[model samples]
Target: LPWHTTGKLSTNRVTSSCSRRAMPELLQFKDASSMRKYSRLQRQAGKRIALVPTMGYLHAGHMSLVQAATDRADIVIASIYVNPTQFSRNEDFGVYPKAREEDHRKLLAAGCAAVFEPASLYHPGTVSSDGAGDNANVVGAGEHVVGAHETFIQVEQLQKGLCGVSRPHFFRGVATIVAKLFNIVEPDVAVFGKKDYQQWRVICRMVRDLDFDVEVVGVATGREEDGMAMSSRNALLTPDNRQRAVCISQALKWAEEQISHREATPSGIQHEVTDRISTGGGRVDYVSVTDAENLQELKHFVSGQEVLVAVAAFFGSVRLIDNVVSVKQAG
Candidate 1:
């Protein structure tokens, strides 16, 4: 297995080299059985495993996650699968960017011990279709297919509001797939990015509530030099749209500043964020200020309690999300 170095990742706090040891040859697995077998073997050998689950099209943000995993575990395994259950029929799952070979090279350089590239984690033998196939199981709207993946995990209260409000099926797909990954990988630790703030909280809640034996680690959101959050979907942004996408981060920062200065209501901050993003040539999907831990939508800021200011907007057809956590101080 020849691993090519593709230069250093441009993510915040992430370097190309693994802190623990030299890069090892990356093992690739395409099916669940083989990946599970390997994980079992690693455990038998007394090696602690860490899992970083991702969709293909690796970027600096993903590399940051890999770096986090490498630091904590003896072996790091990154799973790349574009889950169909997460996206709605109107969403852009069909056009999601993918660079399998490039992703492998990047993960290898980032010190991932292996890459799990399962074609269909849910459907076993059949390939996942592009017609929102997971929706049938997620919402129970259509006739059940014989042997189709029917089981789904939902974090109920935590899945409400934020991205979950708009993309109703999104968290269901995320929680389910991540649970599947936890079982299959059986790693000592699992790493996730906080850029998807709600998703991170949802997974945390799922793990705690279900009592899974894996430690879930949430890494800080990796940003570009311009402060735009890194995401695979950024590949879909045209140059002009990409530039305008900065408003998402800008709005989040502004909200943080406002909350830190004085008492502010969630509605006022949401209005301002919505305005900023809309004026910056983007369509506002949602802007929410909620309790950081429970994700309950807050009416007013309280002293010393952290609140998450999150926004999702569309730059052209690409939807980008960003968030900032702020704690108000008592005057």
Candidate 2:
């Protein structure tokens, strides 16, 4: 039911107009050999472009970012690559959603100027640290071999806790791919969703530290009426488990209330949140309070350092995460 548009349109009607736009033509690339072929078209268009990268299986959360990109730039290019490098052997990489044809239709329907539905590994002209190609393994030349690890970027410190703690290699893989995307897309601005608050913070810090000319903008997380954040993985939820997913967001709200009412200390808040979710039959991943800026745990809250309560839980095979932060939270 949620709809939005990119570029200039009446605030009330952007989504509708975006829908009216034609379904985007697919820009498929076999490998890094094709990056030039695609970027060339972007350059020829002579318009500022924006990038919104995601794992595909588009939902309103991603659409929100795409629409924001369209609002800021003349063109929007969304990448739906589920980079294999980013996932560990035991992670959700195997189960990650891949709705290729459907996603292409969604991207076109979202009013994006181009869809970088790269076929597989993109050379980016940057070889892996091990001096091998990333796509070599996936391409399967018939002899049976694993491809090389292309050069990937890593951002330190900022990724210590939050989602980073659970997914050890997550930010490193994210930074690497994001860096690759920036280099490849070369957009004037890029969009990221604020739902994965830690991911946004990591990318922002990377852009600043790396001195990437592109601007990084964050769109708010899109939510269901029940307050569950929209995610493709949400489809994996059972009807009953789907209802518990809302508890992640609800517990976040309850924590916000605790802080707003000043009733729970950081420890008290953590305890209460974990108790609430666990009692509700949710498998708590990690619940903690931290300094909003540095992501360091707070034994107690300071006057205004900004505090965030973040949680991740398993709902069947899907892991749902939700966070609540102080009004002026730092990071």
Candidate 3:
């Protein structure tokens, strides 16, 4: 159940299993019920498989995850499900960018072996429904309820900082859907982007704590030439907002420079960074410094513990988040 692999797996069981008369053939499934069949096959072969989960509208960030899988796995399966639970009612769940057909083409281009794009597979409750998983009144259950109704994965202390403060249920929704996807897909490894630094860390912890038989790998955030991190939501930005939204990344860069030089305290770094984002005519939502892995608010920066500088802001009506983690610099 340890997150870190010894890389020297016990092959006795593996050898015995392969020696069985008939190992199940590998197959991919899209819906939740079909997952059992795939799970059975994976258990039979003990072969490596990987999953890359995304909301669709593939960008370099996603493609990077796919390529990472190709490097680490014998088979790569990407699931494109715009997780409805991950979105708040007012948070553009209905209109979040989805390009299923385009995503299929992109995954194909990226050399992914297969993709499971589940559509409208969730239970819809009422507007008054509390965001609890136990809500009894299942009003209109979508065809993909198994895909939709996930037992939420909550990693304690990891969700204490960052956008979790404002978007209270965001990570809960994320954790639930991701836990389900992780369970349904049952990949040997799963990939996530470092751009969502907190989410990535939370998921990493969830994998370790829940004893999920999956390795969580984080690919560095893919970015534009001008240094802004790429996001599918970037498409929503108007030209002027797009130009000014660079302030978020720019601020994070400036803060990272200060931290590297020992020139700024966390508070000072955050204030200056938030001010910079705001000065660019964007409305700052939150700018925080936290323990890099756990996303806990930082009281002091210790030598071994990494630091995370994260910010979210509104560029026009669209809210965007960008962050920098204290990754070791190349020599």
Candidate 4:
């Protein structure tokens, strides 16, 4: 639990001396049009709004983004939609962890003003008026619902490689939903975690190329005390695999040290990392270094060049990813 507050309590607005301070009202909206109307009102009133888009099952990493939002804006709206498009047919879309009640509590505790939770933004037909299913799509005029949304935004160049190699449809889903959120929220700023480094870069480029008048800020990745990158999937790791999973981050740290203090070849470093995680009982997906900005694979390290050493592996059915970004400084 990342329960943290930055500013002091307002002395002017007092409810009771013994009573604890009240949490912000957590408004929930299932319609994008309603959310847009609320946001429009906020903007008209001279209030600056910050948007933190997320799939539910909130964690410290997500909370950190909300904290960043509150730090910058007058009000913060957190969108919690488990995007179905981002998950392929074989992926864990159906089984992905969800904690609606707990997530609501956490967001309210974290000072989030409201939560935008539509049943299906892409495919509106998946959800019914009774609210019994998984989908939440936005219906258009004539009450005719789109069965499955095909029109989507794509960040062409940035989505070519890296995680894109494995999860082909991931970035397309991400960009499309995020663009929708930006339009609906009409936020002045949006905060994204850098743990998904490629996703963050792709979104930054999308905003620039598409002319969305929203400033996208990439916040540093939040980590656990043990150094493993915090993710929703961590809970699925078996006890033994959970302990061994530390090797993913350890490999990145080891590679960073070798690059910084000793002469290191990209291939040599990758081989060692692959061996380290493999011997630890993890099935390697990819262990490679690439140019940070373009995500082009690197052959060797050069001074003044920035690179990201990223790794993804599976321990059982759960897949994990971690990375260490290094810049070889120029003299």
Query: Over 4 Å off in model 2, which ranges?
Result: 1-45, 122-147, 328-331
Better of 1 and 2 by TM-score: 1
Cα RMSD, each candidate: 6.3, 7.4, 9.4, 6.6
Q: Give the TM-score ranking, best first.
A: 1, 4, 2, 3
- Stretches of candidate 4 exceeding 4 Å from the true structure: 1-23, 125-147
Q: Each model's TM-score?
A: 0.88, 0.81, 0.81, 0.86
Question: Candidate 3: what lDDT?
Answer: 0.72
Give the Cα error of residue 88 in candidate 3, in Å: 1.3
Please provide, for model 3 over 182-268, each residue's C-alpha lDDT reduced to its tens digit, 9 standing for 90 to 100: 777788889999999889988888888888988999999999988999999998889999999998888999888766655456778
Best-to-worst order by lDDT is 1, 4, 3, 2
State candidate 4's TM-score: 0.86
**Candidate 1 backbone collisions, by pair:** none
TM-score (C-alpha, index-matched) for candidate 1: 0.88
Candidate 2: Cα lDDT at 290? 80
Clashes of each: 0, 6, 1, 6
True-structure RMSD for candidate 4:
6.6
Best of the two (1, 3) by lDDT:
1
Q: Report model 3's TM-score to 2 decimal places.
A: 0.81
Candidate lDDT scores, in order, read 0.84, 0.72, 0.72, 0.80
lDDT value for candidate 2?
0.72
lDDT of 1 by residue, 1-331 (tens): 1323222211111233453564346777777877887788788888999999998899999999999998999889999988888987678877889998788779888888788887677763254434644344434345556667778999999998999878999999999999999998999999999999899999999999999998999999999999999999999999999999998888888999988887678899999999999999999999888999999898887799898999899998899999999888784
The best candidate in terms of lDDT:
1
